[model samples]
Target: MLLHVSPARVGFFRAQLDTGRSGLVLCGPKSLQQARRLRNTEHFSGPLLVDPAVYEVRAASGEEPFPDVAEGTFGFEDPLAVSLAEQRAVGVTAPMTPTGYLHAEDSDALKAAVRRVAALDDPQVVFAAPVDVGWLREEDSVRQLIACLRLVRGPKALMLGGQRDPLAQHPRAVDHLRQIVTEVPGAALLRTDLAAFGALAAGAAFTAFGAGSRLRHIVAPGERAEKSKGFAQSPHVLFPELMDFFLGKTLADRFAGTAAPVCGCAACEGIRALDSFASNAGDRQARAAAHNVAVLMEWLRTLTALDSGPARQWWWYERCVAAVAQYPLLNAQLLQPNGFKVPAQLKRWALAAPAAVTVQPRADAKDYGRS
Candidate 1:
């Protein structure tokens, strides 16, 4: 399966070589240079997906889009910085939304960005990670964005992030997102975030991981080898410990699925469970990051190895039962065979506001917030 790594750079190539992976994910402004360097490096050969920056909503309460450099966004001056190198290396460019930049209201702006990006070079895949449940609920704008995306990048261009925790938000939000999934006419990357996997158990095109856990860890523990958050509360909810467990569970369950599993990466083959991941070599934070990476690789592998077969027959029955025992009503609908649906009230809430047109700059241009 394709193994999409993160942060395009010479170091990323080293990570690929170290792990013997064939797919890479390039993020931030340096993605282009990183992709090129990998092509030049004899140690590796693989395709690269570039996430220029992530765009997502700031809070769950309101419908607003903001630029979160902490979540990672390439700088304005270096928009095409990665383009020249990608051309030279004959590498692919897949612009992904940063951690918190994708808002439904930005559909028009997103389209414009896509158009500008597409003009630079014909990327292997044109993708966006729409994690904002707020935007997904806006049927008109979302459909419009989807149509435009399909037209620009064809059927496989758009990739939307799926439900993480169906129980975390109101029932209306869940329903709206599912409806958004049904209406969109492009490939999807169902990040099994917030126990939303059961909802996607039947026919998901792809899967991804939310940065909640990683983002949390960066702030909660200040564990960066050379980087630091400079002492600020992390907006991400996932705790490192929690991230380890969820990630491990997701992989082990999928590895032996009816649909032939795809991810081929170092972390997947190593760690077995979240607890095991937490103790698997290195410091506590290292193990946590490792676990997160492992699950992400597994997802990449699954997407790359998509095939015709029954979807993975999930067997987390016991864990699911326990979850139901605690969150019965919510879990019942989310895990129901028919899948969950967003309520009218939540739909109204999601559509309450529109996206603004102020292009703000990012903070970390050099390391995409790593530094």
Candidate 2:
């Protein structure tokens, strides 16, 4: 239940922190100064991860020429140097090395990155990669990456980045993620969306998603920016029942009935109707974001309480099944001709076989990264 928010939007999460349910806060490079200030001055004690976002710089093509972060933008030529700077700035004990998106065909680069990171000799280091989703779909690529990952003596994390949503494009993305987690006992999935919950059920060490749409998925190099120039973007409201997010205005239009769905999260205080989130009021948008985090945190707590692997898997499976069942009735209520299609990822979760339940002892810092 990690929440990824930009520096500007971090204040909106005060309500979430007050509950003490939020796990970790992840922000991009630009947030280094603010994050450090919060830790030193505000006395905020939660774990804060400042991602260098080197992947954005590396993923850009010659035409784009570092579309997001240009060379020397942060006064460092090496991306990992930028990440190390963030670690020092925030005083994080466990450091995560900055990495770039590696394509499936580039086995040489993958092995090189793994070997280089392992040479750092930091047992607490987190070896992370922004991987192309094609690797998940290709068995050979998954095997190759997993083998290389085994050589690194540290915790490993993968971020699926591309032009389109990996979970939507690759039907077996969750299955592949499960395989990786099974092979690498404490692997993490970062910068993801609802699919992360499935990863948790599959025994992933950690998972994170953005507070807004832009941070939810990592865009590949050369992909066109989705945001239009002048139009103001509306916050996306998460529909817990449907297990999907809809634009605030779109959700409002769909629930034209007298009673729209209502959220029971602490942020909403069990009184805010779903359509109310569509309002243009500034406070309403913040409330909507808070509501989203509350719902996710509550679900995470519920799953964690079900201690055994089998129990968690069964609980998540049933939840996905229920969400899939709601689409047909929702379309009928809206008087639309099947306008909504169940998300492929949700459908996969409902239909996939439950993974084998195993009990593995937690790996400590000393044991982590050992081949």
Candidate 3:
């Protein structure tokens, strides 16, 4: 997975590079000023990307401006107006209106959007719409993606905005999503949010997530947003590689029981030994961000080095199995036996590792998919 860096988190990327960690960098900010600042200060020379702050655009359309719509955004175009959190500055796109997924029934609009973006100076333009995972289940999911792929002429990855898990967890969903991947074999796929990591096993080029762990999921989120922000922000811990998360825990809880010593990732080793907390939100968030990136980097390196689909599959499967074994909750929810069937390539690669591994079925298991 490529490390998608924002202007605010350039340090995370630089720190990883300075320490000899490997990852592909793609940089940009929703604002031209911030993007310019990142280019000038961070010396980030990678391809500039358009990070659509889709959250900035409210879904309910009306003639009046949204109350939360960032100020100063009155004339900004699609390429210019993308920031989600802050008030708009002069020339920024005003009150982005969240246009729901048009690709479902409006292929003409989707193509027009693609062609319009293809005309931009940036190497890649993220054509993201606030979409639910159910779009994959639509009859035309394959056709819709292929239509866009046909029109994209240059170096670019098509981003499907939405958390990938709800659709991805189901067997039919994988079949549908994988069809798009298979048909558009050369197209680069970008899945935003924490679930993006899961796409790697499904054949996406990269899985990108935002800075700070809390900003991880948005589309079809199973739960509500964190509602407990008070005068002081609590410290947090996350292990992206291990698929573990512990939010708003006290500093003392970090080292307690299985949580102590933190993650063993090289990135974590550097910060895990520190105070691990700060009264300031930025400091605490930055700490958690480092841990999250470190774990992801470790997994990225390991996955890339595997160098064979079957070998990669075998490795992924083994780690997932081990992870579920260690984190009991995962057994109930992730990489379930029913959701997996040994692909021909993976089965061939399975030979590289020991064959003692067997997927035994439970007596009460629902036949969620082929085992």
lDDT of each: 0.37, 0.69, 0.44
Off by over 4 Å in 2: 18-21, 60-82, 226-233, 356-371
Which candidate has the highest TM-score of all?
2
Residue-level lDDT tens digits of model 2 in 312-348: 6776787789889989987887787565678788888
Candidates 1 and 2: which is better by TM-score? 2
- By TM-score rank, best first, the candidates go 2, 3, 1
Q: What is the Cα-based lDDT of residue 288 in candidate 3?
A: 62
Model 2 clash number: 2
When summed lDDT is taken over every stretch of 10 residues in candidate 2, the lowest stretch is: 362-371
lDDT at position 241, candidate 1 = 16
Each model's TM-score? 0.48, 0.87, 0.61
| Among all candidates shown, the one with the greatest lDDT | 2
Model 1: lDDT to the true structure: 0.37
Candidate 3: residue 358 lDDT (0-100) = 47
